[model samples]
Target: MKSLYAATCALALALPAAAAELETYLEFEKAMPPGNLAIGPDGRMFMSVHEFYGPELRVVEVMPDGSTKPYPTEDWARAPQDDADGLNGVLGLRADRDGILWMLDGQGENQTGRIVGWDTKTETLHAIHYIGAPVARPTSFLNDLAVDRDHGAIYISDTGDGQNSAIIVVDLETGRARRVLEGSQYTIPEDTPMVIDGREITLGGNPAKIGINPITVDPTNTWVYFAPMTASAMYRIPTAALLDESLSDADLEAQVERYGDKPISDGSTVDTGGNVYITAMTDNALGVTKPDGSYEVLFQSDDELPWPDGFSIGADGYVYATINELHRSPALNNGEDASKGIYKIVRFKSLADAVSGR
Candidate 1:
């Protein structure tokens, strides 16, 4: 006899055109700490645990019935307490073309960050690259990364403390990195202020300034889209221009294109069709930009999504997001602790259809 959870998941996955439905799949009891998420080809979810103390990374296998088995592996959980100089824990999870999971360890404040790859089959950990200063700012918060599997190059965003935000490019094969756009027009924050909860929030303590947060590459791997958390506008730079070593700063600056105004978005991902989905923290919604340059509210859930952070689109087309209440937490702003949780806007395409059709 199949369990109820399994039956529900079976029916959900069986529905071919059901991708557009707006639904809440799961929620954690306590607030989910800051983190990043990656969905493997097999549908298993890998998520990072961002906090002072907890499993540095966790793997959850969603059963056929929708129940989750959280098996925290030793290789992913081990922290170097003694070597406090190095990156201690994982912040972002991304799976490369070979089906191996890559974890971005943002060594906290003073330490150099590192990217570690885990073999899911053997549970072995391998250090692919260590991202540090001179090329990247010492205070660089290597927040998120996108990989070009074909070229073996990875692009990382350095959300510095202030106007020093930059984008660092790394050659996976050579283990060498270079800062492509530092203090460039596209790398800086926009001039528009972000109004959240009826009060304006400043970027790096400056009003109406731009501070780069999360970035995502288009499905075609042609463009990289980025936005500052404090600004509503989004911008993009062609991958050709960014990856070209010969392109002058002025030449690269002229190619930047302003995508348009979006909600206070944190993490972003693009589907196979070139539709970009952004986790809009302020609006409590997922903002969708279609290929035709039109924007629409794909889904909005005030109760389901609060301070939605990094998210990834599963091969099945489902978009999962982490709802971290950074704004609600007093530690960040006013000493208020807004509990965080992980939530998924299941059947995103179906929900997009339902919302737009209405």
Candidate 2:
């Protein structure tokens, strides 16, 4: 959704176009196109591949030198739906302050999912929390997750393949995962349509709309925020309400609050200072929302960041994003491979730096 005329003017004045800039951090010439990113406390960058053209590693660590290596072990990245190997599709990743790398791994065919906890210090996967049939159905599509280390819990957004969507929460201590607010208003997308560069997104000549996609937890872990891919409004529910198994589905859904609105965003991440940075794909720009709910256009370049899909914020106050040049793929152009290996992981200064005269 376009901003109000007055807000647009204020944002333009706040962030001068001349200062809007990004650096080419890493370029992928191979087929391992990235989907999302998470930066460790010590500054190591980990990314998810989300099943590329043929078969590639699902998770990798970006070395300081810019080379990529499969994380944990290559066996986990092995091709051919290895249930024994313990991972099918990795869509989201977040490294909490306690040195734990949390992942949302979903198996679409079986409609099964698991929230995994990888101990970066020990270099091993210490936990595998699964979502069973009653919660995650054949239609459920678990897209991304937000980690709440303060309460030892993790929240995931299940943006189903079709129209249905829901939120799933897991308790680390007992490894119990439950589906809350299934098919609720907060989880499903409204009537808003998705169009980029004056073209609609379609798969097999049908309009493709994604729901309940991007999710992020506030730095303080007070609330969990999520928004649909095709909707403008962002909603949040109290972290306590989500972790409270005593609450009924109706009671938990009642806690959802419409914090505000945002442009169509793909990926989101929150900094230690509590500012939320999101990739606004529609405007071909990056947006930053302050604590008070006001947002600004940090930058909107035409040539670069055409499809800012995911983000990872570094301790040095820089945010890294993967520009999958062709966002929704060549099928958006009638079944031709328009993407010519032009994928890049770009970095820009912090949101505060981008808006201020830094």
Candidate 3:
């Protein structure tokens, strides 16, 4: 039997540049994909698919040669009996130090939202936390998640449309979860309407509204930064404030500071220097916010970089993102899905240099 580490080592090689002008990587064939990306500690790339009805999860491994291989499994869907109608899709994925793959289950159509962990060593699945019933709206769409392994906690964004929108903090050790920020103020709706390709659009065919969607935490477990999928303002709060039960709601709210006025950002990640890399969907560019509260466009691709969904800062100093054409589909406010591909921007320095001023 081959180990996951061995499998990864056997495939390590230099991937040929896909494009000369831009750093082109392999494009995994996907259909209507959602939150689908996870980078292993060994520098291997993995992505999943979110097809509407069937074949919910399609896992793919990107080799160093810029080639791709798909995991032979259509059984990634694990729907509980309670939410039989909901669809099982892998949204946010994180491989902890133990090689366990933690996934955020965004039960799309069927509406059952939960978090599960896949132990590759044991080849088993375990439900770490379940979100449903009285605490949160059953239809609440749990989007992305960021884990603080040092403190054993996970912060998730509940981007519930109309029904509910809030940030959920889960205690990994205790299996307890709480809804910290809720309603329009904290989970405020976007003021400027979402205009894609000269037309207004909304995700899931509903009216375009602001809700907290994608989130990313700093490497030191100090801050968790997030923004609404359609909002222009970026907000964040200290992990200490969020994890502390003694902090009053007003105190926690006061700690939530506006990071900056950003474009339509779907996903974000911070480097070691506390610089936040945000996928600005509206401007079709990748924006970077330094530690000094200043933001700038790191890289800009023509309209081809549409609807950038997730962010993964590679050890090699390249920032990767998934460009899902969510606004293009009619179900998402009648937008068009063009230039949908995974993209990476490489810094002219090593990961350490990118973090520290070389």
**C-alpha lDDT of all candidate models, in order:** 0.64, 0.76, 0.65
- Positional deviation of residue 139's Cα in model 1 after best superposition, in angstroms: 2.8
Q: Which stretches of candidate 3 lie over 4 Å from their true place?
A: 1-22, 30-34, 51-58, 65-74, 77-87, 108-111, 204-206, 333-352, 355-358
For candidate 2, the clash count comes to 0
| TM-scores of all predicted structures | 0.80, 0.87, 0.80
In candidate 2 the C-alpha lDDT for residue 304 amounts to 72
Worst 10 residues of 1 by lDDT: 349-358
Instruction: Kindly list the per-residue Cα lDDT of model 1 for residues 75-172, writing each as its tens digit.
Output: 33645566532236666677765777777777566567777776765656645688877876766777778877666777887777547788888787
Candidate 2 residue 317 Cα shift, in angstroms, is 1.9
Question: What lDDT does candidate 1 reach at residue 175?
Answer: 88
Best by lDDT: 2
The sequence of per-residue lDDT tens digits that candidate 2 reaches over residues 1-358 is 3568887678657543433676888888647777789889998889887553433688888888878898767877544354467467787888888778887887666446777788888888778888877878787878899888899888888888646688888888888788887778877877766677777767557776777888888778998888887777777889999988899988988899877667778888776655677788878888876566777777787677677888877777788888775544654657666665667798877755555445
Candidate 1: give its CA RMSD in angstroms.
8.1
Model 2 segments more than 4 A misplaced: 1-19, 80-83, 326-335, 352-358
Task: Give the better candidate number (2 or 3) by lDDT.
Answer: 2
| Number of backbone clashes in candidate 3 | 9
